[model samples]
Target: MTRLPVLRTPRLTLRGWTFADTAAALDVYGHAEVARWLSPEMTRVPTPSAMRLLITRWIAECVGLPPPAGRWAIERDEDKRVVGGAVLLRLPPGHEDLEIGWQLHPDVWGNGYASEATYALAGWAFSHDVDEIFAVVRPDNARAAATVRRNGMLWVGETRKYFDLDLEIYRLRSADLKLGAQTSQRPPGHGNDD
Candidate 1:
């Protein structure tokens, strides 16, 4: 069996999905608000058996993949709760690019968890030789788009073919990532950690 690696940030844990996280996974997907941005096929409340299978598949994929690509369970360090997921998918065929995506519990909205985790993951990807990272957020998801921007990604306009819905594309390069690093190192009280 392959083991999934764990990634940590100051406030979050990005790790492989485990059986223990199935309930939280289901809770995240089962919520209408949380599922709004996901594929329609996965919008329903997942059965425990189905969630287990999904988690198993995710663990297998992570173990077999290299950096710049894989799914992760987003856990909150304060409460140690599995809140959601983050993914860095290797772009398809002609693109030879990388795409970053994430979803968090609705309750955590407004917190900077998503942006913090995204910046850390993007840094990790850069270390693996990924030159660029992009994110496609639905036009209606203004909050997510803002998070992408706050992380130093520039809005590159829209793409119709990227998802089931029209999406606004945002991009960040390894060079642009230096800004995030500097911002992250600021003394406490200078800015919110989230």
Candidate 2:
């Protein structure tokens, strides 16, 4: 497998995980509010051992594993602190699609990091031959849903997942590269940059 390369944006760095990031991961993942929109299993604060397992799993996936096609640690350019995570996973055999996901600290909630990261990841995925990219957001997560829409994804209705909960699905086809292009053309803080 080819090594995944690091990606940089105006104020963020998207790169591979490292053991040194444990503390940041613990802080972000342990926050209930941050995990609320994610799977329930991730909601509970994880112990050190559990965090180690999580980091290991992330490393495995970053190495081009089956479950996670790609995962990046979103680091702030100023402090180089790990503020969040962005992931792209290949759907199981039957689904044959790609899924994009992101999680950030509440402090940066309104700053457009999620939207920028999603746009970058979606662009990267399609550039590498992924046919489609989608996100399964909770219906109540208005912020996340808005981010998806801002990135040019269309609502594909709702569906139940392994977690046994109904989720709103938003999708963007490879042909829909316009979203990424539009996002790239805008300066930060103007319009769809959010």
Candidate 3:
């Protein structure tokens, strides 16, 4: 339950969520395009206040969550703006597998941010002793499927185990990662919140 690690890629920084990031977060989650993919577990955040409450909950929950299991704000290094969100959480029903997810604003859709975030998350998780990670995409989510593939995840087929809906599962093992593509983590006090 230490502070969420700060992950840095060449162009983006993945750090802990903060109340101060509500508006920027809303810019991503408030849009129908982005929220449509996150069904059942989350709906479109209606307002800045609602987004703030959600961030508060995420912060509180992470304090008790295990290493590599927390949410992160995907910020662009050049502009220092939050462009999306990322998470590594235990899959439901079994809670044995770790799932990696990313949500990006439509404005930044084609920028390779999702792929960068995916690699960063995978590297961070593996460095903490996680053997493998998964990404479950809705059957029709081509963008997500492509992103996972671009990150070197292999399609393992479909399942209805998570969220009670059909999803395409993609997996990446620690041994599959390329050397030097790993992300660098800042210490507890070096992240956004502290």
Candidate 4:
């Protein structure tokens, strides 16, 4: 089994999904608001049983996936709640580009969990020798676009290359990640670690 590294930030832990996380995972993937943005790649998870199966597949699939290219549950440290999901996977077709993405339960939308996860995932990918990571956001997904921008992902125009959807592509190099860390403010309630 490929053991995913546990990545930590001030307020979140980006770690592998476990069977115990199935219900919390459902709270994130079962909602249409979160699922809609994931269409074509993933459909809304309908039932607890289905979600359990999906989690099983995810856990099984991790063994074969390359390092740093897998999914994680975005768990908040304060209450240890699984607030969202994060991914660093290869884009489709050519499979040469890496895509960084996050999906939060709508209830936790403004807490900056996604932004923190993005940086944590990107830094982890960089440590694995990946050069640049991209985030493909639907033009209508203003919130996601803002998160990527906040993480120092540069706008690189639109593409229909990945999920067969028109998406605005944002690129982030290792240097850009450093710059973003130097300038971006932590979300309220997030501290520099007392």
Candidate 5:
């Protein structure tokens, strides 16, 4: 498991999570609007301390050698604060397909941050030799589906492959990516000089 590199887009930065980000993590996860899309059990983590534990574990697993595929914080470039989170993790159990997902602060819902972060994630995965990256969304989550579409993913209908919940899967290949994806995701230790 290679570590995630710090990625830059025109408007946001994608980077590793740390304990210092716990407050923003809690606020994003605890919000009813954000948690509604996640699983029922996830909604129960509404406290900062609980978010701290999750962040601590995530850092341990993902910031080390053989890091498990995991989420990275979506930071606002102008403010240097985490306004959301994005993932490039493998699907549970089988770990066959890499899944891409994101949750943004409700205040930033209509912005294109999700799409930007996802594009960077897809590019980074492809650069690392991953063949297919997926985005699984509840059929009703039009916004997420739209973000996948913007990143040039094709709808694969439905499946209960991940989380044991029926979901609409969107897939993208390295070749399917629009221009600039390959160059956008700089390698680990490679600064986002682009």
Candidate 6:
């Protein structure tokens, strides 16, 4: 496993989560708007201390993560606040099942941050040797679906295949990286939150 490097887009900085980011992480992760679509592991951090502990664990865990598979703190470099977070990880314990996801504070929703953060993460992941990246969105999560779509991921429709829940699956081949709506100033329906 190689250390994941910081990734940046025109407006966002996808960097490793720091211990000092606890309060920001707590503020974003604790909000119902941000937590609603995230996994239980993210929404269930009971306290700031718990959040810090978990972030510490994740940072430690990154050491063993294969290339292009690590979590990032999504920062709007202009404001330097933690607007949300992004993830690029190998799903189900295999290197082939790479996934990309993003979460943004509702207050910052509709500003294209989710799409930007997600696209940046996906681009970085594609730079590695993997052939493709997948995004598993709950069937009902329209916002997330839009985010993936805007990033040029092709929908493979719904299935219970990956996370055990019925999810809408999407994929982007490495050859297609940065070739579509991902580099646009504002993708269609860009105001939606994830």
The numbered model that scores best in TM-score is: 4
Of 4 and 5, the candidate ahead on lDDT is 4
TM-score per candidate, chains pooled: 0.86, 0.86, 0.90, 0.94, 0.85, 0.89
Pairs that clash in candidate 6: 110-191
Question: What are the runs in model 4 whose C-alpha is more than 4 Å off?
Answer: 189-194
Flag the better candidate by TM-score, 2 or 4: 4
lDDT of 4 by residue, 1-194 (tens): 78888999998998888999999999989998899898476899999999999999887877778988998988999999999889888889898999898888988877767768888999899999898999998999888887788778899999899878898999999999988777668755453210
Residues 10-125 of candidate 3 have per-residue lDDT tens digits of 88999999988999999999999999998578999999999999999999989989998999999999999999999999999899999999999988877777767877898889
What TM-score does model 4 achieve against the real structure? 0.94
Question: Which candidate model has the greater lDDT, 2 or 4?
Answer: 4
Better of 2 and 6 by lDDT: 6
For residues 68-129, write the lDDT of model 6, one tens digit per residue: 78889998888899988788877663446888887787778777777777667776766677
lDDT of 6 at 22: 94
Give the whole-model CA lDDT for all candidates, comma-separated: 0.77, 0.75, 0.84, 0.86, 0.75, 0.77
| Model 2: per-residue Cα lDDT at residue 122 | 75
lDDT by residue for model 1 over 1-194, one digit each (tens)? Answer: 44545779888999877889999998887678788888533556558888888888878878777765788899999999988899887654445668888888888766777777887788778888777899887888877776777777888988775544677888999877777666555443344323
Candidate 2, residues 79-185, lDDT tens digits: the string is 98899988887644354667898889877776778876876787788777677788888888887887788777889889876346778888887655575457545
lDDT of 3 at 184: 19
State the displacement of the C-alpha of residue 54, model 1, in Å, after optimal TM-score superposition.
1.3
After best superposition, candidate 4 residue 174: deviation in angstroms? 0.6
Which candidate number has the best lDDT? 4
Report residue 139 deviation for candidate 6 (angstroms). 0.9
